[model samples]
Target: MSAALVLDFGGPVLLTPFELVADQPGTPAYELLHQRGPLATAEQPDQVWEDLQAGRITERAYWDARAEQWHESGGEEPDIRAMIAHLYDPPRPELVREHARALVRDAREAGRRIGILTNDLRAFHSEEWIERIEIVGDMDVVVDGSVEGHLKPDPRLYELLAERLGVSYAEMVFLDDQRTNIRGAEALGIASVWFDVTDPDTSYAEVRQLLGLPPDGAQHG
Candidate 1:
């Protein structure tokens, strides 16, 4: 059986929405974050975000709280999707990580089927915005939770991706920034890597090794 590579969309494939907002000051996202005050910021740590990271709170609950906060602050519809659209309505290719693109290309060159298993592609992005992302088009398959109604750590989601890629769990390697999701994949007998957003190159190197591709700057046949 051939090896396959599956990646989570948010942190592994693209700069996260928080990182994007941080980079672009004077934007609505930036303003919203500033107004929210201390939610995942370096200067002022927020307990809610900490709870989310510590697995005390669900991802959906965390975002639902943020949506209510956004609405209270005079923002649009009190939904996580509304917040996502507000922050990323006009998606740009620059938001896609260059290293991720290279990893996908290398995997393709190495004859591995590539897939994206994301919990919120359609939930967080519009059709037009999704179309603008060239890296997504490079994937052999994309199984989205918004469309499939099943999110990871759900075994069914992993099963769906494996089914689409025509590979067994053992024949695939998965990468995700969230530990819970990583654990889920690992439990299913899939080799999984935790992508560190802080040091992406290291994660990329690990992925390359897992896929049996040449290391960065080494020759590839």
Candidate 2:
């Protein structure tokens, strides 16, 4: 059966600096936020980020809000806007996996619907960054957590992606590095591949099989 492949940005697509900023257990970023106050106990960082992605807050507003947290904690506030600008500008340090692109090409050529469902920051979706990212190029549907007002594990995000792809929940094959997100997709009856960006081959093997494509070849229609 033909399936819609829903790829994640943070892990399945490419790694970014934000991987640490997220609320991953034992991550230095998460630990730092905890030490910084507000982000630790507050309905914080993640929820605030969701609001930013949902368009409830502008980029400037997000910074201002975050700055307030810094002020309350009396911590040194790095100029994040400046950093975001530098990282996304020309000659950014992003590695586009060659194999991943081939898989996308093969899947599209075989008539499979491809979608990018990501829980990404605002800067990552800027026009300049989007232009540079090839994975987003071949996607039939693109849904961002910030734009959807929902994140993975919430089920709403998957529902929104399904709506965009015009596919049933069961028809979507999702790939994400986070097991929590993978489990979320699984609960929705979506076929899922738990990707470990560190050891991607093991995950890609499952993705290839799910897409009904050969391990290393152009999938013919």
Candidate 3:
């Protein structure tokens, strides 16, 4: 019997919000929004994460809405769609792309079946980011939040992925960057690894260790 592995999209293999705007000032998207009066206090950051996880919105809506909020705070409107297009425009970071590909190749060679369980909005569906990151080509099955109308922690999405993969929940190993999402998977009897893609406080070595892989290509015990 083959072990099934389900990987999260935004963190394990892609540039997270932190990596995307590392050089920018102010807090990252994971931070709590400061009470900036009524106009700037329309949405919470966690709500966006939930929406992403719940399949309530797409990535474009998340970013565009964020940009709108940022503009509203300054009482000026910025071209949010254009800005986001530029943000995701650059080439995929080589280190992440290489490592992810290597993992997939090695896992396949090891006879493990792999799939993707991502809470991506429809915006990400059409973005170059998908192709650049190679999500479409690598995974055996992908349960996209926007496409399926179900998201992480919903139980339905996990069931859908498991059903498609023809595996039981306990036979699956899931990985993600968010603790809440991990907890959700745990509830469904899936073993999980947390990928910390954000925070310079967390180095790549830490990520490697968490995944039970070494920085120098050695396998973890």
Maximum-lDDT candidate: 1
Give the alpha carbon lDDT tens digit for every residue of 192-212 in model 3: 776654432233344334334
lDDT tens readout by residue for model 1, 91-143: 78788888888888888888999999998898888888898998989999999
| Model 2 TM-score on a 0 to 1 scale | 0.67
Clashing pairs in 2: 53-146, 54-146
State how far residue 172 of model 2 sits from its true place (Å): 1.3
Taken over the whole model, the C-alpha lDDT of each candidate is: 0.82, 0.66, 0.61
* Candidate 2: C-alpha lDDT: 0.66
Between candidates 2 and 3, name the one with more favorable lDDT. 2
Candidate 2 per-residue C-alpha lDDT over 42-120 given as tens digits, one digit per residue, 9 for 90 to 100: 4344666556445465444555565455445443445554343433445343545566777788788778899988765
Error of 3 at 197 (Å): 2.3
Query: Residue 159: error of model 1 in Å?
Result: 0.7
After superposing candidate 3, which stretches have Cα over 4 Å from the reference? Answer: 23-65, 73-84, 90-97, 125-129, 198-216, 219-221
For model 2, the run of ten residues with the poorest summed lDDT: 32-41
User: Which candidate number maximizes TM-score?
Assistant: 1
Candidate 3 contains a number of clashing pairs equal to 1
